[model samples]
Target chain A: MNFKMRQLFAVARHEFLNQFNSFSYWMMFVIPLIVVTALFKYVNLKFNFNNSNFINMVWGFSIPVLTFFFCLIYIGIIANSVARDKTSKLSEMLMSIVDAKEQINGKMLGIYLLLCFQIAFYTIFILILSKVMNNNFLFLFIGRVKIGLIVYSILALFVSLFMFLAITVQFSCFITDTSQISSATMPPMIFLLEFFSLSLLYNSVGFDGDNMIWIFYIICMWPPVGSTLTPSLIASGNISYLFAYSTLIIQIMIMYILYVKSIHVFKYGLLSNKKKNIFIEGFKFR
Target chain B: MIEFKNVSKSYDGFQAVNNLSFQLHKGEILSLIGQNGAGKSTTFHMLLDFIKPSSGNINRNNNLNIGYMPEERGLYLKESIKNQMLYFASLHGMKRVEALKKIKVWMEKLNVVGDIEDKVESLSKGNAQKVQLIACLMFNPDLLILDEPFSGLDPVNADLLIKAVLEAKKSGTMIIFSTHNMENVEKLSDYVVMLSHGKTVLKGTLNDIYNQFGRSKLDIVGYNNLQKFEGMNGIKNIDIINDNSAHITLNDVSFGKYIFDDVTKEGYLPVFNQHYPTLDEIFKTKVKQSE
Candidate 1:
């Protein structure tokens, strides 16, 4: 491998191993399995239901809820890792080797792989639980989870992660202490969560298909906002698969640009120890 | 070779390094001495490109690979000493195997005894410092900039560090460091730069600096009644401890023979040694003059 690639791999490996070494990794993976299993068992013991609509509701709501929970927990891990490095002043050492862009890319890749691993494990757990409970495996895996929805969900999840990463990177630049990173990161995240809830609520109320399509398009194209909203649009069948994919491609391109900008901010923030308004520092490029 | 020309760094309106310029030859060890906040750390930061100069230029002739040990030593407390050393070496462009080998050699040279797998936090302060110093030198960079490398070290460890620095200099590494200890500078520095209030007040070889200050002393122990030369016209200052012994600083070199004659007349003189000014004396005079 070349120098940049080698350095990138080293960073990614360090990040991955550090997370794996933590107690929280196992907790995140196993807690979801237990919760899903317990809920399935409780529902089976409490009622004998031949009602497909009830099952459909549970399935639809559960996937989004579970996905959101997993994503939230994982976001904390990624944010804390970034924050810890900044707080401990290790970011300066990393910057000495590669520029900001490579560092972010490597970190993002590590978190992405970690999320994929969690998602894969949860999917397998659900599949096995269905077989044991004699529920329809096809409905669990394929029927409720359309290929289009799955593709869009993955895309949306990545977009959201990149957006969070960007915001954290920018905030981390202005913060000298790790204690401030959580407060610094909360604003963008709260905005993203609000947008996510609104989109889900609109989908539940059954908005006009065309109006929903327009909303999804706008969200997918938005610079930092697109990360959370794009996938919900895809899952709700508001946008066609082709249109969602195309918009996602454009969103990724925009995220790349924003990623570069945020890395520049992060580079400066890591070295600065003085107190300043994070928002002001993020915009004042030097 | 390295050069910083008219470099000025400012944060807000306050200047950290104000119009600073200096040069380092290939093999000389330059000691940068200053009071706290006198801009020595800022100069080191500019040398490594950690912070940009507001206006001016710092030029390096080649691809400058620098090994920096910051005033606050950068090492993961939880990481094993071997692991941390290897990680740093790899970052400096060494392969893992080579880095490991170099770590072993350095650990042994420093007489560090412990399992290589022990965490850095488990090591004593002096041992941890040795590990940090080893990490800096493991890569054998062309330029080594150490900021207060001996701050928390005891005398023995400090001497060990001085020896290591001397060896690096012999192998042709341009070493620049900042320290508050003037004795270390006297022992190890070939050239010195004394800064006061963000300005270079004194810069030259150690011998040249002391020569320019022109205050010499003679210690006489056996002379009885040395009060005859106490207020001589040739003497700029005279300090007498008891009647037989005195230290005199001369205004002229010609007075050395005159003092010798006067001492000889006092009685059989047992000890009369001329003393050149030390770096400590020169530093005190220079800083006082700046004020």
Candidate 2:
């Protein structure tokens, strides 16, 4: 590999291993999943969705909620990593090797890898957990879930996760002190969390599956929350392919825009520690 | 070689470095000596392209690899020494096996107290500094910028670092460092750039600079009651270092022989050495004069 790519992956590899080395990172992965799974079992026990397409109901209900929760948790992790780099002056050291742009890009790639690993682990864990629990509900969930929708949802899920990770890192460059961290990183995540929480609740109410809630569907199509929300909707057959595909396309486009914008802001902010008008800067191509 | 010509930097209309120009030839060590905020850091920043020069330019080979140790230290305290060091070497494009081998060599040369696997946070301040120095030098950079490398080191550790720098210089690496310590500058710098208030007050080969400042000074030792030369014709100022020794600055370069003759007229001159001022003395007088 060339120096730039080598440096980028070295940073990414260090971060991936560094984060994985921490017990807390594992707790973040395991605790939420176990809790969510327990909650699923409780719902099954109470509502006894025996007649309701067990696999579809559980997955559609659980994946959206869990993805949003994980994203929220990860915002803190990714943002704090950036903040630590700035506060500890590690960014400057890395900057001497690679420009600010590659440093942030490398960090994004590392965290993205971690996120993918967590999601994949959760999938396998859930499959095994239901099998070990001998809960036939999840096994039935198979075959009923539209394979196409499941595939799309997974892709959408990763794209949405990338959107959050990129934005969180972008904001992290602006955070110089520990105190500014929450104010800088929290709002976007909380917005997604609130919207997704509401979306999950709205979906669970047995609204007629055939009737598309136009305005609600429009919100569901917007990234990055839509990336999280739309997939579950696809799994349960609530939204049409036409609107879902368009939303997915639009979400990817927005993600691409943010990816480019975040790289610029990250480079500028890391170097200057200046809080210039980001809105204007964001629109700038460079 | 790196040449910075008429380079300057400003923040909020306040000049941080002003019209500074100098060149470092291959294998030469240049020490930048100044008080805090005197543009040493700014100069290093410009060299690294961390901050742009507001005017003028710094010319160096485009492919010149630079290793820098910033005044604000860049280290991950929670990370192990081996991991972080290898990571930095990789960033500089050094192969992993090569970096690991170099790390061990540097660790031994630096006499680092802890093993490579130890976390940085667990190392003492001085040992941790050695680790940082290893990070900078292990990559074998073409140009090395060390910002206050001797700070916080005890005398022994300081000597160790001095050896490391000399070794780098031996291999033809251009080295630039900033420090308030005059002894190191005198010991290491082939050329010195002394800045006061962001402006270069004095810069040149040590001998040439002292020559330009003139050699009308004498250091005398073991002559009791040296106050006898207070009325000497060529004498400008006398600073008493102790009862037996004093530093004498003269009004003319040719007065050194006269002073020696006059001081010895009383008989038994234990030591009479006329020489250029010590770098410490020159630095003080120069900076004070500028102020």
Q: Which ten-residue region of model 1 chain B has the weakest summed lDDT?
A: B84-93
Model 2 chain A: worst 10 consecutive residues (lDDT sum): A275-284
Instruction: Please give fnat for model 1.
Output: 0.11
DockQ for model 1 equals 0.36
Interface RMSD of 1: 2.4
RMSD of each: 3.6, 4.0
| TM-scores, one per candidate | 0.87, 0.87
Query: Candidate 2: which stretches are off by over 4 Å?
Result: A36-63, A174-184, A201-254, A268-286, B222-228, B231-233, B240-245
Best by lDDT: 2
Give stretches of model 1 more than 4 Å off: A45-67, A86-94, A123-139, A173-178, A206-220, A239-250, A275-286, B224-233
TM-score of structure candidate 2: 0.87
Instruction: Classify candidate 2 by CAPRI docking class.
Output: medium
lDDT of 1 by residue, A1-286 (tens): 7766776776676667778777878777688678777777765543324554444344444445544665566557666766776665565555555557677777777777778777787778777878898765434445545565666666676676677667666765677666776766676667666765765664465458765667657766865455455455445545566776777778888877777777777777776767877767765765
Residue B115's lDDT within candidate 1 is: 72
Cα-lDDT of candidate 1? 0.73
